[model samples]
Target: MGAATGSATPRIVIAGGGLAGLSLALALKRALADGIDVTMCDPALKRDPHGDKRSYAIAAAARRMLTALGVWDRVAERAQPILDMVITDSRLQDPVRPTFLTFAGEVDGNEPFAHMVTAGDLTAVLLEACRTAGVDLRPEGVKGFSIQGSRTDVTLTDGAVLPAALLVAADGGRSRLREQAGIGWISWPYRQSGIVATIAHERDHEGRAVEHFLPSGPFAILPLKAVLQADGTLQHRCSIVWTERAENVPTLLESHPEDLLVELERRFGLQLGKLAFETKPQAFPLSFGVARSFVAERLALLGDAAHVIHPIAGQGLNLGLHDAAALAEIITDVMRLGLDPGAADVLDGYERARRTDITAMGVVTDGLNRLFSNDVLPVRLIRDLGLGLVDRMPGLKRFFIREAAGLTRQEAPRLLRGETL
Candidate 1:
């Protein structure tokens, strides 16, 4: 059952060593041990691992998957749990923003619905785990690939070609592998940019996350773990996602540090006391995309390679992690049955398991962005009333919280359910 062929172990090559790729490699190695060979390639792996200055909101189900993969324990102290969340809608110049909806962030008893962790910390731990699990980590990415019957011949950037039972494109939204496979991408620019930065605040946040729906887009203030300063004083911090018109991003990025802080303060309010930049603000163009297919021949797409949605809900990374978990489970199940992991049936099952979930999230985020990112009088009134109504319904609010926690699916992957493959 361990061998794909009589005396041959299945070789799985993954392109892109981001969160999704690394997690998938680690999960496969840990589950199959020496029975499977997993290789991950990404040019970024050769550079400074901490160069990524982004942070992500890991949902409860994703966190459970990490724990099952032995990643959570290594970075548990660096994770900041969201105890509660508040949502409000208001104009930029409004003197006050009224909270229309609030949620207590617990899904299963004491388990937090989500946790915030910086990209550097989470990737560092996953990389270490993959290394310990004996996954072949290549600093070069897949240059291209060709499917030949039951296997894929992956060409690396270094002019090396390796044939494998499966080639997973965990590369991100602009995946070259996906393009080479002729997967049609359905995408549209939102004409907006998401500005991300870490800021120090004088007051504690008490693990509360806030989302203010402005006419431009959603402004998220997510709490981060405290950091000790050079002077030996603990500094409270929060990660902010400021969505603004794409045309305005260049000016905001080029603005003087003081001037930028002023813009931040306009929306940040004074509830957290004085705010100072802990990291330079960076902006990324926002867009919505979904691949026409998640699998082709002997290849499978994961993470941003398969889909990219607006950051309005902060579910982008979690969605990718879900892909990894689902794909890993399916591959494990097929291989344990002594079947080819790259079989048409195997890929079909993977697609069937994920396409609906991905499409639903895309629709949801797109709808939310359109519903909230406007200033029409009637639209605002209707949205506010809806929020208020949902807030008043305890059952509905709990359902949303659980959905955000990624725990609503009855057929969730084993890892998502905190179980090993």
Candidate 2:
């Protein structure tokens, strides 16, 4: 099949079934109904759906997009709203981590700027939504592809061929499809690894998140919804993203449980009473990457395939969701106009819409990582002074809060604003 040409419904083949791909598939199905066909290919879909133990902070705009796609409601009860945030700069052994900045964490009145949700929970909900929406989920991943005029022919690992009006490489930062499309990617390792884990504490976190900027990196404590123990009592919990020097991460990860807990306690403090890991800590190397272009003829890139930045700002997932929302809107509008969704002009619109935003985020995160992940006394004094100034200015803080919530963009996609296409 060659993209259902001449009055037939157009087919869109997404080359990964992670959050980005699944969300895009559901969005297209929900918006266009019988007008389009969406197929997502990924080998991970055949494995245990709840295997990922990580969590993510979903910004206000991304939550709205999920709501528009009928996903947020299903996981709303499990989502923990971040009511406030605290920032401090100090060494690991500092007797006191003086707070340099604080934020109330609201954008428009009482609406929280972000919420924390487990990857397993959110992925499960998105997968279910895609299934209910009639999205085609394939167990085999896209092995390769070839663009042929108005359509791109996708070859699955099993050798089955799929011809689509457009091909999307949501496969990730190491996207084979993107490389095959001749897209240039600029990337570099941060030489730091982020250690993630869930912690059960004696006292409730009260929806407060904290970020401690140390010489090694930023150690973030994010609030999570309460979990019920086998004894039938509710236990308070929080998720942590502990960034450390890459060279030191292996020793930490391989350390004894007691030894690891000791290191964790040093940074975690006693704000939440005693703490213990509810899940084993896992580490992932940090990096920065951006595709030279987000789209090519008959092909497009989404999520990590387009960009990957340091987790210093916790905007990676939200940025990917933004990509899904923007691309879906552009493609839907193009199809509604009786035009080719994979046409050069259509792809250009998506690029034009996302390029500036992506570049700005990459720069901000890279700068923040470099500035905060060091112990130079002068640099620390300067950054702390800057943070103190920014904190004292309510207007500037509010502007930053709105920006983090993804609310400052006037031309955002309809789904991101919680509207149906």
Candidate 3:
């Protein structure tokens, strides 16, 4: 029941209109001249309630990408730059249980490592840009997909079949279109759940972010600017990314708001004031997932569809944004040059350029997760030593800070270099 993309302006079909999908559409529309066509399918975006629960820690490069797409300034008010990040162990019984770590953000130059922005604020700005650029927004989700001799046929939940030069699968993990295209993913559950919530504090955050290492996972406190209540009362706000064991997640969510805040306060220490304003809490199972291949005959997997890493580094969304920016650049350039948008050469080039970065990040994040999540004595000794050495070595620490900010050297795209609109 879908409309076939006629020999129109190199029509690119994107599925899943969350951050990655929408951002890709907006970025492509801006980068491509001559009315490049884009279509995105997402159903849940318009119906999101209590959008306050979702947020992200976007790297400096990701912010630059948004600025190039003309969406950053629109949502800047809701974002808080991370002035500093402090890491330490969660051993109260053994005070020095190898407790040590490094600090990023502000340590380099005047710039913070990244900005923490809520998903709703980001999506609102992206959606507006997509509309202004005349990109087609499909309300129905992708239900199925098929590959013909030279084309890809995408079926939506509405029963419409649409043809595309390239089928982009941005649907989250467990994508139906990826499976329909016969693409398989490699995933391992960490037996962890990410408990996300927003808390109002009595003291100013000073734009500092904190990450605490515990047996469960990292407990991250991300600063956010003051929030305006319905009645116009200003409140200091910060987001908590608390990772807990899967079995314990249910109990934690069921815990009374007061008791949960108390536990968080105790675990978080008194550096910041006590947590007061508690929003509704939600949790999702955590895992490390990567699709073996990023592309097929006419289908390409992106965002969570391609890889999912630990929340410890808060790189999951940043990685997803990177995928969006990279794919958009490659696809738009090839199409503008009058080449086949989904040609084997073009797609292969993209695959080759992205593989190295994706693999390296996946390995680094996985290694960090394994190292920090475990409480083994040897790991404690080695990681603590590693942390201390890295902390003292300014050069090595700067290298990591640069890497974390997505400024590492590579043949990065122009937009990836923090291009401003």
Pick the winner on lDDT between candidates 1 and 3: 1
TM per model? 0.98, 0.98, 0.93
Please give the lDDT score for candidate 2: 0.93
All predictions: root-mean-square deviation over Cα? 1.4, 1.7, 3.3
The TM-score measured for candidate 3 stands at 0.93
Runs in model 1 with CA error above 4 Å? 1-6
What lDDT tens digits, residue by residue, belong to model 1 across residues 47-102? Answer: 77787778899999999999999889888899999999999999999999999999
Question: Once model 1 is optimally superposed onto the true structure by TM-score, how far is the C-alpha of residue 249 displaced, in angstroms?
Answer: 1.0
Give the residue spans of candidate 3 off by over 4 A: 1-7, 48-52, 92-99, 229-233
> How well is each residue in 237-350 modelled by candidate 2, as lDDT tens digits?
999999999999999989999999999999999989999999999999999999999998789999999999999999999999999999999989878877888888888999
Q: After aligning candidate 1 to the native by TM-score, how far in Å is the CA of 230 from where it should be?
A: 3.4
Determine which window of 10 residues in candidate 3 has minimal summed lDDT: 1-10
Ten-residue region with minimum lDDT total, candidate 2 = 1-10
